[model samples]
Target: MSSPPNMSTTTTLQASPTGIRMITPKSTEEDTRLNQVIAQVVSFIQTNLCEVDKLTLNTGLDIEDSPRLIRVLDAYGVRYFYHGSILVIMGACPLNSVINTLVLNILDQRSTILPHELCPYFSSYRAGILCSGTIKGKGVRPQLRIKIPDDSITFHHPGKHTIYDTIMIEVAFSESRGDLHREMLQYFEHYRPAQLAILVKIEEDLSSRTPRTDPGFRDRAAQLLLRFGNDLGKEIHATYLENSAHDTSVRPEPFTDDEILEQIQVEDWIGTIAADVEVWDLMHSEPRLRGSRTRLFPTPDRNSVPYIYAGDMIPLALHDSFPNLNVSQRLAIDTDLLCMRMAALIPRFACWRAINFFSPEDEDEDMDYNADDDEGEE
Candidate 1:
């Protein structure tokens, strides 16, 4: 410094306090190319397709949270479309597989293209549309439906609250050709109203006269029913039995209620359990029911073990329904307890019900709630 350092030396020694580094950003040319490619694909799909209205570019969206994607789509007016596990396109888009292939070809070559992260977005987008109840057309309504057993137990414990009245347990069994459906019917028929509902789904093909047959399948099916179904329901309720075969080619149409009962010898339990739970929960906590209640048994011996029944049907030791309470007063006590139990069960069942059947409105509302919670946390 005393000798007056050269210009080159002074420049080399100069450094900023902010630790800034000089680097070039992506070129305008490259940005133009990428945007052009995206536009081309979107335009091609929209112009040629009959049902497609607009294309959604999920550039920064996280595909894992389907509810978020659905909300975004709803804002943009995307009603219905088919969906897989990933990627969602708007409008009555018919060429879903073809569009997926095209998108993959273009994006797969990129080093940052993560299929795992991207696929679920599209899948959930499609699910959102379906849930919106927009998949209506001609035959069969093009709707998604789950076939539950029309057995007696399901009727009583149709939703989660009833199912979880105590601890819940589930068991699966493989069915045989001619006897898979019949065997389950025979085991559960005796219980009638008291028996658990059996929901049978065909997971594989079980042809009566097929060369490819599973010899152990029938025996295994019978054994499962006898063990779990018979053993568990020895006292409280009848056992539930359901089966599914792999063969879809020769699979018969879903059995009618009467036909299923006649063949399976059980009751029919249908309708949305989630809806029932929501309605029931609201009724239980009503001001009218809460205000008109009085405690008949204020205290019981802590040492006494309460006998828990299948339906949470605990038998009161006192014959008067409410011990030390008069006949006029007993009605209120019984009503209050029944209402409380039902109310408690509704929300529990609603959660379980939502898992199986999600309405579009429900999905949107949930997304809004999550957004609010996230904002609050931040």
Candidate 2:
């Protein structure tokens, strides 16, 4: 290949896949004009490029006057198309090192599209799919975990009781489509280990008078509790058990058995159990539930153990089974009990898996953030 006259730029160039050929003009007069024109073209390309693309190209272009260079390229009649920093130059290239450098420099800029930058876009679609099984439209819900503060109780006797408390809840969903489990893992991978506690509610007989108040009630309740615990552990994994050895605060050692029985108010116990069951019901419901829809389990201000009839056998079974267990054991039991309850009332509920997201620190942070926002506006 002969060098273009007075340009000192020469080489053979392959046609693009689309067969667009670049023609290099060789006259001395034309060379001088082309150099001036090339400058203008380069200037235009730089100016019109997206901010992200421009930052990428600028690093290598190293030209103090990029706008001028682009204008020179424009004057020479080189057409360029931009696809996110990828510059497809049309027209003529003499195939010299200078031209090659320019092409390669533009290609190098393509590397700036990082994986994390693309995640949000990908998750938007994935979130839609994951939430499709939900009752709410395609919106993602926020997931939350709450930890109750630890407080000491005073006794007229000589002993002090140390208490540790925590709770987990899934308050929101991530905005994405596809498999929620995978997306959740990826989205939360950057944070410390956390568990999600979902509350599911089901209608149960709570009337104060009934027939099966003795061994039958306890037996059935224990079985129902065992069922929920087993299924939840199997479906969501045993690692999420609130009272697992790994979860120090939920362990039974923090307080003596007598203190545990005394400090764990009946209302607190029922409220926590009810919350878990409500979430289970939502997840296990037929036709599936939406993120926007919620089932509330209101705890009575005054606590009283309801009398058990044959109609109330199932709920009573759950209550008796749950109250006697420690936090971890209770979580395990609730998982199974809820699953069994769903099986009988709504057969379709058997197919879904429970995802846990229980964390107390996260809840506190959210509260603090909201408080700060309120204070700021004042």
Residue 175 C-alpha lDDT in model 2: 18
Root-mean-square deviation per candidate: 27.0, 31.4
Error of 2 at 364 (Å): 33
Which digits, one per residue and each the tens of the lDDT, describe model 1 over residues 59-167? 3322332343344445545343323322334333221122223223222322222223322221101112011122223321122221111111111121222221111
Q: Which candidate is the best by TM-score?
A: 1
Model 2 per-residue lDDT at 229:
33
Off by over 4 Å in 1: 1-34, 41-45, 49-76, 79-86, 90-157, 161-378
Q: Single out the weakest 10-residue window by summed lDDT for candidate 1.
A: 273-282
Please provide, for model 2 over 8-60, each residue's C-alpha lDDT reduced to its tens digit, 9 standing for 90 to 100. 35434435557755434234553344344444344433322211111112123
- Candidate 2: segments with Cα more than 4 A from true spot: 1-138, 142-167, 171-188, 195-331, 335-378
